[model samples]
Target: MPDEPAPITEHLGELRKRIFWILATLLVFSAIAFSFAEQIFLFLLEPVIAVMEDRGSKLQAISPTETFFTYLKAALLAGFMASLPVTFWHLWAFVSPGLYSQERRAVIPFVFASSLLFAGGAVFGYTQVFPLVFEFLSGFDTSGLIEQSWTMSLAFSTTARLFLAFGVAFELPVLIFFLAATGIVSARKLWSGTPYAVLGIFVTAAILTPPDFVSQVLLAIPMLVLYLLGVGVAWIFDPERRRERIQARDEESPGEPGSDSEDHSE
Candidate 1:
């Protein structure tokens, strides 16, 4: 027999517990990141620094608290990055009770893949996307008539947004895997909806990326690739679809007695 559904109060309590643990994890990691805030800040600033060096530009602090706040934001970003694995684990734990035994067995792989993909996305944004964006932005000073000093706050916010956008975007495959595994969507349906998915992806890219064609295209390309990859993942792991295919094949072949009854029982 299946387990009973959890009571509403129990569900709420579980949610609260998950939230508390996630918050605690965030705080602890944030504290650790704060200790290395300067290094994190510098690491994130590399692309900007490269562009600025080429153009002899410098970053400035417009307000007295700007530098402090920028460092604080950087620490928060770093903390979140460091705590991502724990966060994902908590998320999986929270939802695992609704999954089958076989599905629950996927927790470790899910957490590991989610973390790896997010970090890979962030690194790609920093190393490949940011440099191109910064280089493009630097070109606006071709006339050299205007001063090209960017404030620390602006730089931090811009880089942080892109880092976050890429990280979240990279989770597409994992999200699709879950949806497929849960029977919310199927690989065949996703494949048939390719055009619509491409459209949605471009729209999402436009929303997430900076307001420039180059940035939009760069983000969209990866997102499109990830979507296709997600469809492949869904095809491979979707149990419902696999069962349907098996049923269809069985119906087409000459079957032993009681096969239909066995299928109905299943």
Candidate 2:
């Protein structure tokens, strides 16, 4: 017999525990990040520094508190990135009770894939997208009348937002995999909705990226690619489709010669 369902109070208690674990993980990573906050802050400024170097410009801390706050913001961002694996694990653990035994075995793969994809997206933003954006903004200095000094707070905020946006966006394939695995959507259905997906991707890109056509296009292109990749992953791993294929194969095979006699005896 199957096990009884958990009580509502028990479920709530489990949820609270999972939430605490996630929070504790975040806090621990945040503390570690705070220790290296200056290094992380400088690393994040690489792209901006590259552009500014060419123009003989430098970033400034306009207020006395600006540098301190920038360091704190950078530490927070670093902590979140560092704690992603723990976060994903807690999330999966929270929902694993509802999954099949086979599905529960996917916990490690899911966590690893999520972390890798998020990191890839963040790196892509830092190396490819951020440079273009900075370069485009620098183009506005053609008149040579306005100075090009950036405040520490402004630089940190802008870079952190782009980093986070790209990282979240790149989890498209994982989201698709979960939706397909859970039977909430099919690969064919996702592919058929390409037009609408493209529209949504562009809109999301516009909202997440800086208000510039170049930045929007750059972000949208990768997102569109990732969406298509998601479609392929869903197609390859869809459990329903696999079951259908197996059933079709069984139906096509010849039955045993004495199958009728066996059925009659039974």
Candidate 3:
């Protein structure tokens, strides 16, 4: 009798199950977030409130529904952020079996690093960058001028954009590490582009930030630091060099594919 078909079919079944599980988890978290949406909004607005308080200014909502929508938006963001680990793990599990042992070893570290870096970026934007930016921008109000009233929707949108941008920027090292691991970039090449890269970081900062030097510098400096750190990470994961080292070691002793031989001598 022909043996049962290989486990390839089982992989598809497993993938579908994992996908369902991930969706269910996200839905559950999203509901929780939606229920406490107001608290989430308040937490999100803390930096804005702190900055305004420091400047002796106030933020206002123009529309009756503005605060509610802002809370809803914050809930969605919170849901996605909180569920990221579950999403990543599902994806990792789906692709894991197809990978060699070494590839499998790399997956967890990559996921953890990406999540941590993103969190670091969000914290930096909230705790440091936002305050400086608001302080600089508040100066534009001028004395005896019409009092500025900040709309809730506008405030939420701006803060969300900043949070997302910084979080994405923090993934630079993961991007570089993957590219280097795939042999698409080399440590030497990345090192050589340092000057241009630094210029590009600042230029990007200028484009994305509000029209003020303080915000621009705050974004650019951290971006440059992240890029430099990415280069170091890419160097460590440089696949071409890693392959060469492995090959040289292999040539030193004949061995079966993917297996090492035990040195035997009397």
Candidate 4:
């Protein structure tokens, strides 16, 4: 007989262990990142600083602890990015118990795809969205007006938030793939839920991005694109689709009565 499913308590225990390891990885990477927080800050600021230069605007800190805290947050964000491989592995481990042996074998591809999507999201946000957001916000500062000073903490926090948000957003396809693999969600189901999913994506974009139409819309468009991509992922891994194909093949070949079903059931 096939092995029995694990009890809920065992599943919960497994989840707790995974979370502990993931947190440990985050801490390790965060420590590594803290050593180079200054470099990360300077790299992130390049776009905004260039825009700020035109208007003599400067990034400053109001509170004494702002810089320290910002650096800490930056380190955390960097650590989170660096730990994507560990994070993805934990995610796969958490779900793999429910997957068929064939599905479990795709771990390397799953981890690689998830990590690549995360990096792609961060790059898109920095390259395409960041410049537009910085340009629009910076345009308001006129050199003639009172000195334009942006808070160091605010800038860094916003950058980190958007980077993290984009990275998470880009994991949609991977999420769908696993859901399909586990028989939790199918492409047909996703299609039926499209309207609600879109509403949720836009709302998430509005929440995560700066309070600007361009920023929010920029985030939303790519997410919608990813949603389409995720639907494709769902279609490919969807067991319902696979079952249908198998049934069709069996019907065409007219295999021995109940043999295919028995083999599959076994």
Candidate 5:
């Protein structure tokens, strides 16, 4: 028996339902995170806390409401991170109808890699970058002339921004892979553009990190390595495509007297 085609209206209805479900899943996670806001805040502030403890500095909240709102913000960020998989799956499913089997296969590795890379980047920022940044900022304080007090809102906001920035930066490889797969660019072109890519990564690092060379370098180095990794992965994964292109070029070449290529030699 032949399969029946879905109506446009039915497809639209299904899309709406999926969107609703994604939203519902996000909301559920958000509520759960909010319920555990204190723990989430502690988790987010772990690196800073450890650094502060080592230096005998206190992290203080200027206002009573600051702590409350900081926890709420932490919970929201946690919820967003937790719900990302559901959101991505819904998005993948929604657009899957437009892709062929090969395209779909290529997409699977990218999606999985992207999620893992993002999580790893976040962990890197939290464990390595955050402590270093906090230490650098804290070191600038004078004992008698100045007082060091970090606002809860400012601390949490900065942590969240850095975490998100690192996470997105780690997705560079996935972006490259998609560009290569879609023919917008090739692995060879990406490899050839290494200098420009390095410059761009440093620029992005300056923009995303605190106004310090150490933080900028920390972000830029990882991004540059990831870009190189992307080129290698694209080359290895698409070797068959490269071979086919080479074969096609050879077949189209005007070689011998009785070759398939029609000679318009001048």
Candidate 6:
């Protein structure tokens, strides 16, 4: 006999358990990250710090508690990123029951790709976008009248936020690929929404990158490319098409369904 499906209450309980483990993992990692938060932030901001030095500007701590809280924020961000593999695993574990065996086999690739894409985006922002945006901003020095005194809190927080934003934005392709594969979205719909997606992408890029056209375009272009790639992937893996193929094959099969009905009639 076939196994019975789990009830909604059982599903909810399973979800709660996964959420609990995810949160616990984050808390533990964040505590560990707190010990090395300063090192991590310094590493991430090394390039920007160099640009600021060139402009005779440096990150400053006016208030006593500002540095402490800044490190805390950095720790939290690091912990969230560090725990991504576990988070992805839990998410896959929850969803795999509803998927075909072949789909279930994709969990490893999904987790690896998601973590890599996020880190790659952050690296891109650090290597390419930050230097350009900061260099352009630092170029404007008010004709050397007032000295530039950037607050530590604002600088660290803003850069960290932008790093996370860039990382999240880079996951667009994987997200679309998953949704299209699962039949939640279709290639035709994504194609039709290209104009609006372009507008939204630019707007998002503007928000995520610094206030510079070049930086915004830098982010937007890659995202647009990824969006197009996702559409192509969606066309290939779309479950509806797979179902149609199965249906066509069934129609060509002469007696599979008829034999079942005839056996029932006897």
> What CA RMSD would you report for each candidate?
4.4, 2.5, 5.9, 5.0, 6.5, 4.7
Score candidate 4 by TM-score against the native: 0.88
lDDT of model 6 at residue 219? 84
Model 1, 15-73: lDDT tens digits are: 99999999999888988899888899989999998888877878889999988889989
Task: Tell me how far the alpha carbon of residue 50 in candidate 6 is from the true structure, in angstroms, after superposition.
Answer: 1.0
lDDT of 2 by residue, 1-266 (tens): 22268999998999999999988988889889999999999999898988898999999998999988899888888999999999999999988888878888899999999999999999999998898898888889788899899988898888888898899899999999999988789999999999999999999999997788988898899999999999999999998899999999889988967998999999
Q: What residue runs in model 6 are displaced by over 4 Å at the alpha carbon? A: 1-8, 209-214, 244-266
lDDT of 6 by residue, 1-266 (tens): 22258999999999999999999999999999999999977987786798888876788989999989988988988899899899989998988888777888899999999989999888888788777766776677767786877787877866786688678788998999999987799998999999999999999998886677877887898899989988998989988888889999988988755898889899
Q: Cα deviation in Å at residue 23, candidate 2?
A: 1.7
Q: Whole-model Cα lDDT per candidate?
A: 0.89, 0.91, 0.78, 0.86, 0.81, 0.86
Superposition TM-score, candidate 1 onto the true structure: 0.92
Model 3 lDDT at residue 228: 89
Of candidates 5 and 4, the better by TM-score: 4
Residue 212 in model 4: lDDT: 82
The residue-by-residue lDDT of candidate 4 on 1-266, one tens digit each, is 22369899998999999999999999999999999998988787777777777776778889999999888888888898889899999998887776668877899999999999999999989888898888887666466566667888888877777787788889888888777778788899999999999999999999988788888998999999999899987888788999999989988986678998999999
Which pairs of residues have clashing backbones in candidate 4?
Answer: none
Q: Pick by lDDT: which candidate is best?
A: 2
| Residue-pair clashes, model 6 | 0
**Which numbered prediction scores highest in TM-score against the true structure?**
2
Per-residue lDDT of candidate 5, residues 74-162 (tens digit): 88898888877777677767756666566776456656777788898999988888888887877886665776667668878878988
RMSD of 6: 4.7
C-alpha RMSD of candidate 2? 2.5
Q: Which ten residues in a row have the lowest lDDT in candidate 4?
A: 139-148
> In lDDT terms, how accurate is model 6?
0.86
lDDT, residue 121, candidate 6: 88
Off by over 4 Å in 2: 1-5, 256-266
Error of 4 at 61 (Å): 1.5
Order of candidate numbers by TM-score, starting with the best: 2, 1, 4, 6, 5, 3
